[model samples]
Structure formats: structure tokens, C-alpha cells
Target: MAWVYLFLGGVFEVGFTTCLRFTDGFRNIPWTIAFGICIVLSMVFLEVATRNSIPLGTGYAIWTGIGALGTVAIGMMFFGEAATFVRIFFVLGLVACIAGLKLTSGH
Candidate 1:
């Protein structure tokens, strides 16, 4: 269940990050509100997962991993960011690290 919470938090992390791009430095009220809500919700879920006996370091690494991976993809797909070969390679490396962290965590 903690894993569920953790993953949900990651999903929300991606959402908030995507919304952040649209916020225009908090001048866009709707996107800013969405970003604010998602940030709070993401933190709540992360805190819950940590409380469930997930190692703090492991949980935080995974959370930020998910955020990073998701943000890169969003940048490519939605924001016209270049998806160069080098970028793809690094993103895949990030995936490997995230997976390795999960497997080694002994959760």
C-alpha cells in the first residue's frame, strides 16, 4: 500500500511539474492553483509512504526519480522540447537508476 501511495505521489509530481510550465510565474491563476494543489497532494502521499516504513532515502530518491523522468517526457511530448539521442540515452539511464533503487530497497 505504501508503494501505491508512493507511485501516486510520483504521478502527481509529474502533473504538478507539467502544470508549473503553464503557470507563467504564478501569474496564471488557474494553472497556479492546480500546481499548488498537486504539490500539496504529492507531499501528502510521499509523507504517507515514508510513514509506512519505507526507508527515507529510498523513498525520496524514487520520488525525485519519478519526477525527473516524467518531466522529461512531458517536455518532449507537450512542450516541443527536443528529444535528441543523447537526451533519450540519459533518460533511459535515469530509468535504470530508478529501477535499481526500487529493487535494492528491500522494501
Candidate 2:
């Protein structure tokens, strides 16, 4: 399903972003390669999802929402990144926006 692909894309987006942090500004070959692969896979999945009837705007909004939340989760879990209350609330707001878009889009 397109939603499945979109979700995978989001997961990959988070993976690539976390890998980028480990890449140390591209000085680390392994992390760089991992980041590149994850990014490529994310785009590929996103393209697949776009082939379906989901509206471009709705799909993109949802994709970005999931990516944003997942990235923050990865940062907090693996990168020692801050998980302030305000940041968590903002991420939840993004999730709500994604749900609202999907519900209102009639898809």
C-alpha cells in the first residue's frame, strides 16, 4: 500500500538523518555510506507511494510529519539529543496535523 511505503520512507528518512549525525561532516566513510543508502531508499519509497492516487500535497505533508517525529525520536534515543517538553509537544502537533490532513483530504 502507498501508506506502507510512505511509512517506510519516513523510517528511512530518520535513519539517514541519524547516520548523518554520525558522519561527522562527511569525514566518516561508513556513516556517510549508510546515510547515502538510507536517503536513496527513502526517496525510492516516496516515489513508489506517489504512484498511487494519494494527493501530492497530502502525501508530502504526511511524509514530512512522520520524518520529523521519527528523526526527533532517533536523536533522543541514540544521539543524546535533548527531548524537551516543548519539542515533544511540537512533534505531537505535527502528528496531529498529518492526521488532520489525511482525514480532510478524503483519501
Candidate 3:
């Protein structure tokens, strides 16, 4: 359950970041509001997960890992960001590390 919360939080982290790119420096009211909502939800879920006995360090690492991975994928897919081989290599490495953390976390 805690892990589920953490995963949802991570997904919302991605939501907030992706919305941030569309915010137009907060001038775009709709996107800005969406960003705000996502960020709040992300924090709420993260706090819940952490308070449920997830190790602080492990939870934070996984949360940020999920955010980073999702954001990069969004950038490449929607924003025309480069998807070079080295870039993909590191992304896969990050995925592997996130999985490793989950597998070894003893949760």
C-alpha cells in the first residue's frame, strides 16, 4: 500500500514536471493550475508513503528516480529532445538502479 502511494506520487511528480514545461512562466493559467494540482498531490502521496514506515533515503531515491525517468521520456517523446544512444544507456541504467533499490529495500 505504501509502495502504491509512493508510485502514485512518483507519477504525479512526472505530471507536475510535464505541466511545468507548458506553463509559460505561469502566464498560462490552465497549465499552471494543473501543475499546482499535480505538485500538491505528489507531495501528499509522498508524505503518506514516508509516514507509513518507508525508509526515508530509499523512498526519496525511488521517488526522484521515477520523476527523472518519466520526465526524460516525456521530453524525448513530446518535446523533441534528443534520444541519443548514450542518453538511452543512462536512462536504462537509472531504471535498473531504481529496480535494484526496490528489490533490496526489504519492504
Candidate 4:
């Protein structure tokens, strides 16, 4: 359950970051509002997950890992960002690291 919340929080982190890109530096009211909602939800979920069982350090690393990976994928797929081989390699490595953390978490 805590892992679920953490994953949801990570997804919301992606949402907030994507919305941030559309916000036009907070000048776009709709996207700005969306960003605000996502960020709030993300934080709430993170707080819940961390308070439950996951350690703060591991939880934070996982959160940011998910956010970074999702954002990069979103950028490449939707925003025409480059998907270079090295970038992909590092992303895969990050995935392994995240998985390692989860497997060792003893949750």
C-alpha cells in the first residue's frame, strides 16, 4: 500500500513537471493551476508513503527516479526531445537502481 502511494506520487510528480512546461512561466493560468494540483497531490502521496514504511532517503530517491525517467520519456515522445543512446543507457541504469532499492527495502 505504501509502495502504491509512492508510485502514485511519482506519477503525479511527472504530471506536475509536464504541466510546468506548459505553464509559460506561470503566465498560463490553466496549466499553472494543473501544475499546482499535481504538485500538491504528489507531495501528499509522498508524505503518506514515507510516513508508512519506506525510509525517507530511499523514498526520496525512488520518487525522483520515477519523475526523471517519466519526464525524459514524455519529453522524447511528446516534446521532440532527443532520445540518444547514452541517455537511454543511463535511464535503464536508473531503472535498475530503483529496482535494486525496492528489492532491498524489505517492505
The best candidate by TM-score is 4
What's the distance in Å from true for residue 51, model 3?
0.8
When 2 and 3 are scored with TM-score, the better candidate is 3
TM-score of each: 0.95, 0.90, 0.96, 0.97
User: After aligning candidate 2 to the native by TM-score, how far in Å is the CA of 33 from where it should be?
Assistant: 1.1
**How well does candidate 4 score on lDDT at residue 86?**
94
Tell how far residue 83 is off in model 4, in angstroms.
Answer: 0.8
Across residues 1-107, which tens digit of lDDT does each residue of candidate 2 receive? 88889889889988898888899999999999999999999989888887776778787788788888998888888778898999889888888998898789776
> Which has the higher lDDT value, candidate number 2 or candidate number 4?
4
Residue ranges of candidate 3 with Cα displaced over 4 Å: none
**Model 4 weakest lDDT span, ten residues long:** 52-61
User: What residue pairs clash in candidate 2, if any at all?
Assistant: none
- lDDT of candidate model 3 versus the reference: 0.94
- Ranking the candidates on TM-score from highest down gives 4, 3, 1, 2
- lDDT tens readout by residue for model 4, 1-107: 99999999999999999999999989999999999999999999999999969998899999999999999999999999999999999999999999999999888
Error of 4 at 98 (Å): 0.4
